[model samples]
Structure formats: structure tokens, C-alpha cells
Target: MNRSALTARGTPRRRMSVEQRREQIMDAARDLAVTEGFHAATLERIAQACGITKTLIYQQFGNLSGLLLAMVEREFARAAAGFTAARQRPPQPGQSGFAAGVAGVLEAVDAAPATWRMILLPSQGGPPELYERLDEARRLTREALVADLLAADPALASLTNPDHEAAIALLHAMSEELVRLRLSDPAAFTVERLLAQAEWLAKAMFGRRG
Candidate 1:
């Protein structure tokens, strides 16, 4: 009777179980990861910041690798919604849609350099399993860009046809290049330069070239 009572009394009650708390921990880790670079994010640090024990993180997330993967996946979802899918649905038409799509990504790159930096320059050598997450979001974004361009100027639809696939490829290249430059050295280029050059590239490809 005494042993059972003692054990029961000693057992600590958790505010949130391993699973629920792990998500919270991961959420905190994600915000930190995006705020601070991935390299600076550590298990101990994240656990401490979350006000939980390190073992709880392991029990919930499986390990650093498991937690890291979850974090990357969440990041990819953000990219999908914020950069890619959103580009597909610009509220208006004409030049504004095209300009906004490009500008939106530029803003994200500036706002969350750590997020983009991880994609361009992965830390922790990266997880091989996560290889497709970024590409999937990026591919979707590229496709959205092409669709936006066509919508903005229906004239493009009538005058195409060296290759439909080529159009997709070109948009992908342009999006990637813009993101690359945005992430490369943001301070070097003014907003005007960035927008002007991007518009020029878009014009070169879709405006008159085709």
C-alpha cells in the first residue's frame, strides 16, 4: 500500500502529453528555425525554449532527425501556400497579377531569408528524404507563374507553340533565378532594380519573344 501510494504521488502530471507537446515544441522550433538559421537550431535549445525536457522531444518526435524532418515538411507547406499556390490566384488581372506574383516571392525571400537560405544552402548537410519537398513547392510555383502570365494577357494563349513544355521550363527557370538572386545578396540590389530586371526577363520570355 505504501509503495503504490509513494509511486503514484511521485509521478508527475504533464500539461500536455508527449504527442501534443511535441507539436508545440516543433512549432516553436519551426518559428525559431525560420527566424534563426537552421544551423543555429538545436534540440537542447529548442526544448529549453519550449520549457520542456529534452527527453520529451525525443519521445514525441523520435529523435533530432525525426523532428528535423517534421520541421522541414512544415516549412515546405508554408512555401506551397505562401509562394506557389498563392501565385496561382492573384486577385486581379493585367500587369498587376504578374507583378504581384513576382513581388510576393521577393517579399517572402526578404522577410524570411532563413527559410530561403535553407533551400539554397542547406545546413546539417540536409536530409535526403526532404529532397523533393522544396522542388514540389517550387515546381508548383513555376507552373502558377506560367498560368498567371497567360491569364494576365490572353494574347499569349493564341501565339504559342514551339513547345508547351518549354513554356513550363522557362517559367521554372525564371522563378528559380529570381529566387536565387533574391536570396544571394539582397542588400546589393534595390527593389526597383529587382522588379525592373524581373519584368525584363518576363518580357523577354512571354511578352514579345513568343
Candidate 2:
């Protein structure tokens, strides 16, 4: 028997690697941020939530700001990866690519509602850095969406004076609202309903182009 693996109390002490411990701390921080608010996700609270010492968290993340930033970046990257994978999937038969993309976004939201809520509907009192990062991500996403829209529909690109910026802004706002609604009240705002509305709008816009 490996006596070294057992605590003095005779129970086996669970050993977690540095990365595992960091993940535990980040998970606690994320849950606190989502359920309460970022203000509630203090080092003391996170340590208590994860049953760890605050000093350990400090050692792993350097400070509260670093911890928060790392947590947000991890979640954002995860959500982005999911969205990118969803977008790469082939569209269903008879479905327009735009509708398919909307469906993919909704699918990503459904997969991680908490992650989406943190990004899309951030709670007040979060650090300015958090909001700044979110703004940058949104800007990049909008730019990509604009490019995709222009490629998908030749008519949009052919316009002598296309207001793509304005159009993309409007679309982005609406999509964010729909995602927020779905996350806030999944039962009331099912993905199917939202996708149908988006598809209808896309069809209407494309119809006018013909």
C-alpha cells in the first residue's frame, strides 16, 4: 500500500496538477460571475467556492484582474471555437446559407448558454477591461459577418453605395437580442422560433434582390 498517498486521517488525498487546480478556480469564478455578478467573484469568494486557499489562487493567476481576464478569455475562446465549428457544417437541404448560419449560431448558444450570457449580456459592475475585450470581440465578429454577407449575396456587394456597416450593425443588434432572450428565458424563446424568424427575414431580403 502507498502510505504516502494517504493523509494522516487515512483518507486518500486527491492530488490535482497545477492546470487542474487552475481550472477549478476558474470554474468557481465563472459560476460566481454568472449567478451573482463580477463584483461577487472576488478572490475570497472564489477561493471559498472552490474550497481552496486564496494564496493559491493568487499564485496561479497573479491577481484578481489577471484571474478575471484569463477566465473571460478562456470562455470567449471556447464560445468562438464552438461557433466556428458550427459554421463549418454543411447546410441542410433547401436551406439558405444565411439561415443555416443563423441556425449554427443558435446551436452554439444552446450548447453553452452561460458562456454566451457572460459575453452577450455581461452583468454590470464588471471591470472596464472585461467590457473592452467584449467590444473588441464584437467588432471582429461584425466585420466577419459583413464579409460573409457580401460574399453570399452578389446584389449586396454590387450596390453603388452599399450601407453594409449600417445593415450589419442592425443585424448584429437583432441577433444579440435574440440570443439574450433565449438565454434569459429558454422556454419562452426556443431556438426553433428564433431561427424561423431569422430565416423569414433572410428570405425577404434575398427575394427583394431578385
lDDT tens per residue, model 2, 1-210: 599788899999889999999989888888889889999999999999887889999899999999988999889898888768756756688776666777888889888877888888889887687789888988877776676676666677554435657767877777677778888898988888887877776655444533
Flag clash pairs in model 1: none
TM-score per candidate = 0.69, 0.87
Instruction: Estimate every model's Cα lDDT from 0 to 1.
Output: 0.67, 0.80
- For model 1 the local lDDT of residue 8 reads 52
- Model 1: how far residue 140 lies from native, Å: 2.0
Cα lDDT for residue 78, candidate 2: 85
Model 1, stretches more than 4 Å misplaced? 1-52, 84-97
